[model samples]
Target: MTSSIGVAVIGAGMAGKAHAAAFRAASTVYSPVLPEIRLVAIGDVYAPLGQEAAKRFGFERHESDWKAIAAADDIDVVSVVVANSLHREIVEGLLAAGKHVLCEKPLSDTIEDARAMADAAREAEARGTVARIGFSYLRAPGIAFMRQLIDDGRIGDVFHFSAHYWTDYGCRPDVPISWRYQGPAGSGALGDVGSHLSYIAEHLCGGVQEVSGGRFHTSITERPKPIGQVVGHSRGNVSTEMSPVTNDDYATFNAKFERCVGSIEVSRVAAGHPNSLSIEVFGSKGAARWSQTNPSQVEVMLHDELGDLAGYRTVPLGPAHPHYAGGWAMDAPGVGIGQNDLFVHQARAFLEEVAGLPEAESLPRCKSFDDGVHNMEFLAAVAESAAQGGATVQVPANAAGTTNTVGTNTQEVAR
Candidate 1:
């Protein structure tokens, strides 16, 4: 027998809609032992945006006040997908209301806010409520398969990793200085896409222990005020006046992990690269590479293979890989897997745990609030290193003074 779980998404932006669609699709793809998700409310600062999103995403109600989602008795799970600065308060409110929360990443704008949210989430966990941070890229078929290979020792002791996440959205001079470019929102490319790269690196390799060297670049000094509202990656026209860009446009850093050395390069203004995240991991016995640009396949090389034929081979992802089986047949060639499909996979994991199904205990999890704080700590170290002219900086062992570890069990290097 299945039940119904009331769901509310507070935000009407690109990520918020993705969360909404995921709630609608998770049941169809995974069929977890949970109630059908009822998308009960859509909330945004703008009533029209909320109303339109509710109508488009099949939510039963819409409101400008995000507080309504927490106050509503019908909502059991809430997705807080607002800007980085909004996460702490919104997540705290929903958690206080006893609602299971799935918040967007980077946790909060500042370490203090992130620590508070992590503490609140810990309190919520003690009461058996779920608190998950969205790292939707983890659900990608290729990435998940890569994780399985690493766990199966196919890659053998990972020693080095290199990752790049680039987008061209900030390249244009006429681009408006929205919240993404403001000081209160945090670092530009480093906090925006760099957070995702840091999470992915830690997700694939292990917790980053220190940033040995870091550098930041700001290509455009200033941007015009937006003439109208702008969604992510969308160009906003200038209004003649310009404001100084307060964030880094690009960043490069070398990191030391528990058992591996890694490099992370992130840019929001790289030409011709849109939403591209390419990663390569080298191990003692083998290596693997994957890219979000071509996400359906993973390329791998093994030293034990025929010497003449020892080269990277592209493997089309299928249900044979972890998490893929939930979306399609064993032989299915990455069916039901798309950019949007990732959120569905993410939501299934969250909802299955919410249902208290035994299998959820063993599944890959949505990152916890504790992990978010750890990510912020790692980012802080990189920023500190960059700010001090590429000086190395040691990262804190724990972000919130808790024993919580960053990354997944398989990704954590044995200490």
Candidate 2:
């Protein structure tokens, strides 16, 4: 087994907290495979929160500046959980500093930034450093299995795919504006939550070559506090007043894939639908469905006219499955894994990378920096296409070069 390594976290809010839990949980799950991991550092712009997180998450140190963590001597890995605008810089800097980085999605605020992140990853790879994207859904047990099934032809010749991720988070107008409402807010739903659909599109269906899409941003502005104090220790609740909601509330796109045609939707304004994320794959011989809310079970639709009636069957998945967490075995189904487990499961993909011989693991189940760059390119192309009245736009040859941010400012998608 590889020796234990030091890890650092670079955000103090919700995601930072989650990664801390996952880092600690990884030890139990990765026992015989991965060596011990020491969460050596935690960083946040808010210094007190960083200190508090260090204590709560058992980090060896805390700093207000992420650069301090990046420049630290003992750091081996960094999890970039900061805001969208900060993603590119932190990821690039961390990787440049010789630390493996797991950056939260969209890679950057713009395609340009995403490309920079991807380029940084490529450079890091050449220098033997590891980097991964933060698309957490790719770690879903059922989704992973589904990918294998599709690869093995369990679903013969996929011709179509329909994926939708809907949440009710944006339905409340009273919900004050956050960073998500501004210019290219960290990938929007397209990059924020929707990248999962796009990633699976490439992973499960195929890479999209062309897209004709339309986007929606119902709340053009928000009502966050008209003014708030930025005083230290009393950061006013900027989430309390009014601000223009500039991001899209939803986005729908039609894509031309290598072997399939599909529709993708990502929305945060789907009223009454709180936190529902599902993907459906239809093939010539069979189909399968995975729901984030029902992560423990995957619905497999097999049409064997020569056998049973054509219907989708529910399959219970648990520890019996390969790559499952330790001590988890589904006796008779119904036992479900929550959002927390997905993080642990996702971390396993990294362990595989850390253990594999060089170049053995090209891509991970979670979004890779390359994947983030690719998704941003696709989104940029789609927005461009939509802005031009839904014309088909060719995807870039590489994810590292997108100079246009608003040449395609068609919609602000719910993230």
Maximum-lDDT candidate: 1
Model 1 residue 99 lDDT score: 94
Q: For each candidate, give its TM-score against the true structure.
A: 0.92, 0.85
**Model 1 Cα lDDT, one tens digit per residue, 304-348:** 999889899988887566556546323377443567878877887
Residue-wise lDDT of candidate 2 within 276-352, one digit each (tens)?
88888889889999888788888898777456566888888865443443423332345677888767655655655
Scored against the true structure, residue 7 in model 1 reaches a CA lDDT of 91
lDDT of the structure predicted as candidate 1: 0.80
Candidate 1 lands at a TM-score of 0.92
- Per-candidate total of colliding backbone pairs: 1, 15
Candidate 2, superposed: residue stretches over 4 Å from native: 226-241, 305-308, 319-322, 325-334, 351-368, 397-415
- RMSD, candidate 1, Å: 3.8
lDDT at residue 295 of model 1 (Cα atoms): 85
Identify the candidate with maximal TM-score. 1
Candidate 1's C-alpha runs over 4 A off are 184-186, 329-331, 334-336, 359-362, 398-415
lDDT of each: 0.80, 0.69
CA error at residue 151 for candidate 1, angstroms: 2.7
